[model samples]
Target: MDMEIDLSNLGTVNTMFAALFSKLGVPIKTTISPTVLEEAMNGIVTVRPLPVGTSATGKVDKQCAHFFGVTISEEQAHSGIVVRVTSPAQSKFKLLYFEQEVNGGYGLALQEDSQKTGKVTSAGMYFLHFQVYRMDSTVNALAMAKDPEAAFFKRLEGLQPCEVSALKPGTHIFAVYGDNFFKPASYMIEAMCAKSYEETTERLKEIESKILAKRNDLRQFETEYRKALARFQEVTNRYTQEREAVDDMLRERDNIHCSFTTERTLVNPVGAGCSSSRYTTEHSIPESPENGSLDGRDKSGKKKWFNLNLNRSDKKA
Candidate 1:
């Protein structure tokens, strides 16, 4: 039985076989066409999850493969899907995973051009993990196997969302996972593009206002200081003038004491100048002679001579 098989239509044939074999509980081998092979080799292929027991027989693009040197098989598709990365060298992505959620948790990731928000919705206990990384650096990551909500907010404190949104080709990855042994749990994760600048501007304005207030306080302190210095100078000048006045009064008192000393010295006795006989002669007067008698005549003559001498001494005094 000869049949014409178009190589260009291999993808359709592979899909038909995959469905048929999956229902029959058997494995189907898929052939890779030239176009698909080229796309996968160039790391431009989209990798989707495959049903159990279905196999695509070809080398997958490295961008879609999670672990290096590992084969892309049906078992891997059922377990966990590898994240697609077009340019691993230049692309920025973040991963947030949570497990075993007894309590609800939250996660967020921000980049220059993209933002992600995630939350765990469960009624049971769970474990959480969140991580953020870039091509050159790991920006932030929560502690492994711990409560992701607290770690998410803690890491967020160091990041400025507005500044992150301003970077070019910025990309961020966010995820949240919850595991419940007793009951089923659900999670929601959202990724979106955004540009933020207003928050940054508001922050700058707040800082500037604080700085201005500080500057005003300094200026007020300087003005008060100048006034206080002027008051101190005025008080000092008043004290100085009062001290000078007191000094002048003391000098005048000393001069008056000296004058009294000089006057006392001039009036005090020197040598025999203050004798008793000189004092008596300068102060005493002779009695007048009585009637007319010879003795009276002699007395009268001496009295006249003494009076003449007294008149001359009075003039000399």
Candidate 2:
């Protein structure tokens, strides 16, 4: 059974370094370059002195160095994505020479640093000089090792901030050389990724546009909310006015009913329009003989005659 190793969980710096070196493959003795350099993966390589006639022809080529091939895809190269090559200062890997070289040729030289008080060429300076280069195709490592100073490579431009910010979308080669005093030195190579200024500007513009669109949406939402609130207020006011009007009408109806009840309580039933008993008596029908009146004579014995025929003629008249 093949045991599966989970490289994702190896969190220690030493483990990561070892893993990166393993991924970079074994160090080449005969100049067959490795093509496994990656972003954020720090790897170490030891450089030994080359023979007298190897790559030490010009100011750029060093006697002891290793070549690495880094490829930038079209997607990575878009939006000003940059591949940065840097040596960690704390990695005990003080550089004697670090530069972006041609795939099959000697690398480009840096400007002479007049401030340093030693050998005047760029090779004598123990600092990293970053540059970008373009190759026609993938490097033939064995061919490069045989004729390491060929004329097929072109030095495109020097990279500021130690990165190839705007390199063409293709695979490129770089050289990391140690001190040229025939001494074997161990150096750590750290790769990093960054975005160029143009990319940042474009991203800021995109963010601003999105924010502006959101603000417009919010403004429109506020406008709609205001309109809805106004309509709601108008409806509430109308409902309140209608309710008050209905209450007034109900009160008026109650008052009319109370008035009718009071009128019914005050007036006599026999005289509907009269409030007094006298008026009631004048309008009432004459008492019958059974109710103590024969000829309109009361029980007090006072006799009074009411002619029935005369009352009939009076009613007719």
TM-score of each: 0.20, 0.23
Evaluated at residue 139, the lDDT of candidate 2 is 30
Q: Give Cα distance to truth, residue 280, candidate 1, Å.
A: 22
Residue-by-residue lDDT tens digits, candidate 1, 1-317: 11322323446566466445434533222222344334433544333332222322222231122111112233332222222212212221222321212232212222121122232211110111111222211133323115453343333233322212121221212222111111222222222111122354355447645654554566566577668979999999999999999988876666555444312333423222222132222445555446455788998799899999999999999
Q: All models: lDDT? A: 0.33, 0.37
Model 2 RMSD in Å is: 25.2
Each candidate: RMSD: 30.5, 25.2
Which structure among the candidates has the greatest lDDT?
Answer: 2
Q: Any runs in candidate 2 off by more than 4 Å, and if so which?
A: 1-62, 81-165, 180-182, 195-317
Where is the poorest 10-residue window by lDDT in model 1?
Answer: 121-130
At residue 131, candidate 2 shows an lDDT of: 31
Q: Give the TM-score of candidate 1.
A: 0.20
